[model samples]
Target: MELQQMRYVVAVAETNSFTRAAELCLVVQSALSQQIARLERELGARLFERTSRRVRLTPAGAAFLATARQCLQAADRAVAEVAAAVGEVRGRLAVGLISTVAAVDIPGALREFHQVHPSVRISLRGTASEELVEQVREGTIDVAFLGLPTTARPEGVHARELAHDRHVAVVAPDHPLAGERAVGLRRLAAETFVDLPAGTAGRMQTDQAFAAAGLDRDVAFEVTNADLLARMVREGLGAAMLPSAYVPQLTGVVTIEVTDAPARVEYVIWSRSGPTPAAAAFLALLGIPAS
Candidate 1:
């Protein structure tokens, strides 16, 4: 069987949906299905039991899945090893990060990488922490920089921390409690807050902290951009709880330390299996050790 067919098998098995697997492999659904069918016919057994609602592996398919994965992994390693031997980093590198991430100087790092490896084509995408994690896990992006809550860690990925800081509350200078050294969630129950929308990692972190403190405050404004949130606070729109680095943009807003707030950790994450040569070179340029 060809390596591409083996790759198709592993992808289908992992996702459990032919359509999704085809999308992940960057191929047409019909072609992928026909190739897998051809492999099954050659093996003289039905590998997958397909129903209308779901796709599942038959006994033979289950037994062959492990070998299929191994073959794909081996092929990947073989290519990586040869690329390493060639000592030329010239390929596509896809990197994802959150918009509010200030832990690493991404622009500066990219500039340096371009100077060092001019032949490499670099692509960068700014997105939310949850989305970044999903992209890295799926190998759509070679690496991602993520800001994670204290209680959260990415699964099935290799992560390297670049920075760590704590969350703080910000409000207009004339707002009540602006001069306080530190504030607690219990004292802010009646206040309206400006924050990120639900489902984002930053929002999830703050929500968990509020839930743990047994306080439910009103979110008066929801913004995805850090500068916009800071502007909302500066304009007396509302108060907000945000990461330390994202606070300085609130020029006129007063930042009050949040007591017992969850710590925010920034991490450089990649697929656990391996990183492409271009990705490895970019990581090295950023001073992150090889995974």
Candidate 2:
């Protein structure tokens, strides 16, 4: 009639003693007896033949005992399989990254994550800060190394800041500004810019920094990828304003300090809950110190 009733029936059948089965189950004999009586009444069958001296199963009781034991065993196996799925530290890690983060950090983290979890398959996606946030929210990716100030503040996500990306100005290796150790926002106003898209917070900061000095930029070109921006600058395109990490060592591009540029921080994020085992491991991987 119920799982507890089935368990009681099986236990009594196994031990051949109501008193011993009750002891085995840590329940009083009278409680076990009453429950068995209720189960028998519910099934409309007498499950045991009781005497003052002994208790023995009816023919129906023997048949039911075997089925009940199998049912309990199956329940155990199901529970164990579910526990292993939720708790195992191996599986696929679907990771998304802002394009610039991939340029700087993903390679090292990818190598380390593989070393620690060889069986885990890593799926990587490259996109912008806003796009990466949406991917995490929609369950298209398990985790992301996305740039911050995600416009939507997507529901059901958790984030951890790995590093703050300080802004740096990049120019051709032989450009006159390249000789300067550090350049000010006012000086940048005269130079045409290769900037991030107009709608980005990065662009806003770039604008505000110069505005503070009673100056404004004439953005000559606009593009999203920092690596691409570096290549453009190397080919004598307009100077790019972005983080040093993204343009570390382009062949013909030189990065210089921007006196009062804003920092664009990066984060490694995961689902607030329901992170697959591998996703959890990957988030842990992000926190690992660089080797």
Candidate 3:
């Protein structure tokens, strides 16, 4: 019932060990267990099923965990908001970005944010654009940078386009197409390709381009990392099409313009409901007006 009790329950649930949870909470194991027991008695439901070997959340505990987390987040946000009113921003900022993000210098931005709001905690993660969008909606990520095909836009979130650029063909220095000034999708389709996995946002842009051109390309290498994709091209394993802005960062590959290439849009997205104080400050630093 009490917030302290909920905190203990959450810690136990996350660690799955009463001893570890006590350590995390900076309290004795017996004290943490006693508080949880008291909470369970008040709720008339056993929150966890504990055995000699391990501790697991019971059905009732699983049902209550989500709301407990939301409540805790709300309480923390309330405190942070009050602190912000007094000219101090104190909260956690979780930022997500696609692996190929080039529109914004995330490291520089984080450095400035830290200097301005030294008390705020920040974390960054890189993944696919779609997964980042999902994380923002789920409240795990406060803000994100995304890249998607020009024809596609993020749904169910607030988004602002940052930049747009066409993809260029990259090949080994000695490859047949390396000396070409420009080529079309059809020309690239004839060569084996190295790209992100199928069904991902990064791969979709290239895939849609090929599909629209009535071409079927062979993707011999599927890699999640952009550097590895460039490596594959450098070793003559396959050719690749990557955003123009990101190409300069890779070495040992020849970049050629694609005359009829797919264009990708870079966007900054946040929760539609609103942004946390730390996220709002970050957006402001990026010159995006508050929504």
Q: Over the stretch 171-248, how does candidate 3's per-residue lDDT look in tens digits?
A: 999999988999998778889999999999999999998999899999989999798899889999999999999898
lDDT of 3 at 138: 72
TM-score of decoy 2: 0.62
TM-score of each: 0.71, 0.62, 0.89
Residue 32 deviation, candidate 1, in Å?
18
Q: Rank by TM-score, highest first.
A: 3, 1, 2
lDDT of 1: 0.84
lDDT of each: 0.84, 0.73, 0.92
Q: Any residue pairs clashing in model 3, and if so which?
A: none
Question: lDDT ranking from best to worst?
Answer: 3, 1, 2
* Ten-residue region with minimum lDDT total, candidate 1: 72-81
Top model by TM-score, which number?
A: 3
**Model 1 spans > 4 angstroms off:** 1-84
Cα miss at 33, model 3 (Å)? 4.0
* Candidate 2 CA-lDDT value: 0.73
Clash counts per candidate, in order, are 0, 0, 0
Number of the candidate with higher TM-score, 1 or 2 = 1
Compare the candidates by lDDT and give the number of the best one.
Answer: 3
